[model samples]
Target: MSLLQNVSSPADLKGLSAPQVEALAQEIRDFLVESVSKTGGHLGPNLGVVELTLAMHRVFDSPHDTLVFDTGHQAYVHKLLTGRHDFSALKKQGGLSGYPSRAESEHDVVENSHASTSLSWAEGIAAARRLSGERDRHTVAVIGDGALTGGMAWEALNNIAVDKDLPLTIVVNDNERSYAPTIGGISHHLASLRATRRYEKVLDWGRETLTRTPVVGAAMYETLHGVKKGLKDIVAPQEGMFEDLGIKYLGPINGHDTPALEEALTLARDFGGPVIVHAITEKGRGYAPAASDIDGDQWHGIGKFNPETGLPFEVSGRIWTDEFNEEMVRLGAERPDLVAITAAMLIPVGLDGFAAAYPDRVFDVGIAEQHAVTMASGLAFAGMHPVVAVYATFLNRAFDQLLMDCALHKQGVTFVLDRAGITGSDGPSHNGMWDMTISSIVPGLQLAAPRDGEQVKQQLREAVDVDDAPTVVRFPKGDVGESITAQRQDGSLDVLLDVQGNPEVLIVGVGAMCSLALTAADKLVAQGHSTMVVDPRWVLPISDDLLRLASQAQHVVVIEDNLVTGGIGASLRSALQEDDQWQPVHTFGVPKRFLEHASRGQVLEEVGLTADVVSTTMLDRLGPTASGRSD
Candidate 1:
């Protein structure tokens, strides 16, 4: 049997010897490489944490111990060791999730896919354990040093250190990158210390010897310690950052070494207060292709690729991101006042090309989404048109800023929200379905959803040109639909299909859902049921003409890719209800629940937003009417 087969849980890991553990680490890496290559899940982060995860499981009793993983993409190895060995269906429907799932395993105590939130969770769990009068149980949080850039992690650290004696082990996994090379003050500080090798060695030796010295005793020790303070001032300058915060700081240990990780974790377990073990690990360590690349973002979350060739299985088509990037470049060229900003998502949001072309205009505000939004607002206040491009999920972190800072002020900022709907594979935390629902509530905020490539460029230009209030143009993560090139030059709405005159059923499609609506319309047309498909480019400032068309139809079916509650459909429903002539309407979209990890197609099919399901549902609704029975 393989070394991995012998391990079912952390308890099973306790029986293995040191050499056996070392062998298991290699086995796990091999399994990870093979599995992730086929499944196209998180490859680089998981590869770096194989030994660290093994050491963690060996040292701590999970579930009981309350071990939390910040940005749980690195938990794949943890998932493997905890009896989830089926990587064939990783991130698929009803399979192992890309991140930790509460339903998947008891070992996964927290379900966090976003970074910098684990420490806060650890603090609460640790405090709860203490409140219940339990002392033996440990609460450990494994957070990346990159995640430390986020303000929430520091807030947790500050709160946990208030007591100065709280038992919490914070493992700082310093891979030097969170998607991209980590930026900001904390990362710079860590980099400075990592560069000064001799200073670190001296400090380690001094701490070890000064506390254990016996010959000098009381008087001599105190005298020497006083002089040693001056010596430390000359040697290690910023060593007191964590110490002053009332948290013990341990070595920048080698994270790849199982023995070193085991030793550091053992010492951390014995330490009677809040402590951080700073471990330096190489992201994508075992994989040669990933290791050789300086930028880890390409390998961060990848699709199915060949292990030998390192080439992905499929080539991405011209996505909405491409059109956004191209248009932003043209806008910058055309208008000197146009500026673009991103919250550490330059590549994913297609701002990399924009950044490269106009470095001065593009700002990467490092994991700080709140700052990105407010900074853009500030730019807007300065008479500059600032376009803040961010992921739909990450925008949730800046809702307060969006509402108070941007909306209340009515700042002329344009938000280009990529992944604006049900982003399938990354699971609940990463889905962008909430953007429409949340942003719809913000007063004076104009929202647009383009159905195809041509509309994307046109809408983006219009959003940038709107100087009155905040405008948001959101699009999905995949390829753009067929280009709609023939729009009336007078800004009149283009009708893709018009059954408005004598329509039995009118389907209002939003953004990516237009294709599905068109398919449903085709099915209805075959069954001799008159149907109209309208793609309302602008979602907000509810289209009056479209509503009028809906009033003319027998029934209106609103199909969107966002949440049902408080989404575009809800707004439309409200508009129709206020109107006296509009008939009954039914809304179809993602349900009000956390969707699991699956392909985009799978999630759409399950939610009844696909062409087949939409067509079927519409046909069912018009069954008696189509059969000429007016009962």
Candidate 2:
């Protein structure tokens, strides 16, 4: 039997010998490559943490001794060891979730997918344990160097530093990159520590002595620790940042070495206070293709790839991101003052090309979303039109900054939100559904939900033209299909398909939902009802033309890829209600619930956002009349 096959639980790992553990690490790596190639998830981060996780499980008991993963992509080994070996249907509906899930395993402490949050969680749990008098229980947080770039990690560090009494072991898994190379000051300091060799040797010798000769032969620890510190000042005078913070600083140990990792973890576990064990790890460790991945973002997260060639099995068509990238490059050439910024996602949001084209103009602000938005506002204030391109889900981190720093100040900053709606496999936290809902409350921020490639460019151009308030241009994850030219225009709203006379139903399609609405429109017309479809590209600041069209129709239906609660449908319904003609406005959209991982099409069908379901719902409401509503 394979070494991995035996590891059904953390308790199972306790019986393994030294050489056996090494064999298991190699076995786990082989398992990861084969399994993840068929059903893609995070490959690079997981590869780096194989030995680290094995050592962690060996050193501390899980469930009883709490362990946390900051960016939970590295928890694949944890999943494998904890009996979740079924990798056949990973990231698909009813299969294993890509990130840590509370529903999946008791081993997973928190469902953290986003970076720089694990440290704070560890602190809180540690604090709670102490208050409840569970002093024996230890809380350990494994954070990536990339996550350290985020402001929250620093906040947690500051809070943890002062406590000193908190029994939390923060493991810094420094791979030198979050998605790409981690930027800013903290990363450089860590790099300097990595360069400074012999920290491991010196720290190991000192820690061993303390453990060996307990002053007063145990129970009295302060005497021996004080002696070790006094001797350390004479021997190792190079005081590091962690030492300055009043927290015990350990070595930049080799993360891949199972024995070394276990030794370090054991010492930290018994440290009895807040201690940071910095270990240098290689991201995409065992896999050659992933280890040397250009910019590191491609290997960070993947979809079914060829094992031999390391090429993705799935082929994709032109999407909204491609159009956005091309436009940014063109804009860069024409307008020198136009700058683009991203929150450490240079490639994912299609800002790589923009950064390459306008080398000086584009800025990657690490993983700090709030800093990126506020920095863009600063750039705009300095008379430059700054475009902030980021994933739709991540913008939730920067809403306060987007509102106060940009919109309140009337900064000419354009937000290009990629993966705008129903971002399938990445799950609920990733979909850009909340952008429109959040924008509804933020004053002076204009919102755009482009239907296709043509509208993407056109809306982006129009957004940049506005110099006063902040403008948002949002588009979805997949292919940007054929653009449907409008028959006419209603204010800024484009009427994609308009019937001859006063329509029985007015179907307003928001952004990518135009295609879905158009299909639904065809079904509605077949049922012998006058139906018109309008693409409300600009979803917010409720259009004058949409209200007029809603007034004409008896039953008005609004379809969007966002939540129905505070979406375009609700706003349009409110406008129609105020205009005296109260049309029965039916809405089709994603429900305000945490969605699981599935294909975009499957998710749409499940949420009743499909063409057939929407048309049937509208037709059922008609009920043989097909007449204008007189309600």
Candidate 3:
């Protein structure tokens, strides 16, 4: 039987010898390459953590002893060990989640894939364990060096340091990249520790000269440790950041070596106080293609691809990301003071081109979204336009900074939120559905959701023009669909289609939902309903002209891709009602719930955002329709 086949649980792994364990690691790597290549998910981070995960399972008991993975992307190996071998429907509807899910098993804790929250979670759990007198149980937090850049991790570390007796093991999986390489000073210190050549030389010299003899030489070396300590002090004193923080620092250990990892983990678990096991892992470890990738992320996440060639089987159309990236270069050329800021994801968020064109203007602020926004506010205050680009989901971290620092101060910071509105495949926390709702609550913030590539370019230009307060440009993932032109441009609102008849249904489309609006309009026309489709370029604070048009119709249907509550549709409905245009207004959008990990189309269909579904719902509500051409 295959090594993996016999392993249903971590206990199954206990029976295996070192050679068999090594064989299992290879099998797991092969399994991941084959499975992830077919289904498409996080590959690089998983590949790096095989042995570290094995060591963790061997030394510390899961469930009985909590194991929290910061940013959960590295938990694939843990999943495999805990009996979830099937990867057929990975990241699909009714399938295994891409990140850790509590719904999957008791072994999986914290479904979050967001960077730098595990440490805080671990601290709380350990504190609870102490209060309950469950001191025998352990709490281990495995976080990447990249996650250390976030302020929350530092905050947790500070508190954990103070306790001194809290039995928490902080495993810093230093691969030196979050999405792209981590920027700033903390990364530099980790880099120095990773290159522990000076410390190694002192130890190696002692091993060769003094320790070669019998017990007498060893005893002499221990008692007369001046030479060793003197050399180490002058060369490289091993007092690193962890030591400075009053936490025991144990490694620069070989993260791939299972035996060494087990030893390091065992030491940390037994060390009473909070300890940091500095495991030096190579990102995209065994996979040659992943290891050699030069661009940002280095196959951190991928679609189905050829395992050997590491090339995608299908070519994707120009996505929303491409349009924004192209426009950024053009904008940079036009405005020299226009700068771009990224929170350690320059490539993934599509700011690589802008960074390449104007290197000085681009600031890669590690995995610190809060820092990125505040820094952007500072840049904006100094007579410069700063465009802060990040994933829509991650923008939640900078909410306070964006609201208080930028909006309150009336700073001209343009936030470009990539992957907006129910971005599927990465699970609940990854979906960008909440950006619109969050923006609506921020006063003086103008939110723009562009429909197509052309509109994206136009909206970006418009967002950059706002000299006071903050402006936001958000768009969903995947291809920027076919352009739909306005039949009649009315200021900020564009009338995409209009039919002359007795006032009936007015469909208001927001951003990419314009195509769906057109489909519904056409279908409503086939029935005997006079339908008009209007696309409001600026979704928030619905235009006065659109409100006037809403009064012309008997009823209004606001179609959007954001949440049903606190979104553009909700605001529009209130405005129409307050104006005493009290028609039965229907709002179609994503319901207030976390979306599942599935294809974008699949999730949209599930939420009733498709054209057929929307049309049928509209027709049913309008009652019996007589056959007549309204358009």
Per-residue lDDT of 357-385 in model 1, one digit per residue for the tens?
A: 88999887777888888999899999999
lDDT of 3 by residue, 1-631 (tens): 8999888888887767889889999999999999999998889999999999998988888879999999998888999999999999999999999888999988888998898999999999999999999998999999998899989999998888899789898899988887777768999998888777443443354456445556432233434345334222322333477778877676687889887677556546755668788888877889998876655375898889999889987678889999999999999999998999998889988899999999999998888999999999999999999999999999899999989999999999999999988788888898888888889889999888898999889999999999898999988888887899899886768889967753589999888899999998888878778888988889876778878888888889988888899888788878888898788788899999888889888999999998899888888888875663322
Q: All candidates' lDDT scores?
A: 0.81, 0.85, 0.85
State how far residue 159 of model 3 sits from its true place (Å). 0.7
Candidate 1 global CA lDDT score: 0.81
Question: What TM-score do all the candidates reach, one by one?
Answer: 0.91, 0.94, 0.93
**Which model is ahead, 1 or 2, in terms of lDDT?**
2
State the RMSD for candidate 1: 4.9
> Where in model 2 is the C-alpha error above 4 Å?
203-239, 626-631
Segments of candidate 1 deviating more than 4 angstroms: 197-240, 484-492, 500-502, 623-631
lDDT of 2 by residue, 105-154 (tens): 99988785888899999999999999999998999999998888889998
The model with the greatest TM-score is 2
Give the candidates in order of TM-score, highest first: 2, 3, 1
Q: Please list all clashing residue pairs in model 2, or write none if there are none.
A: 554-629
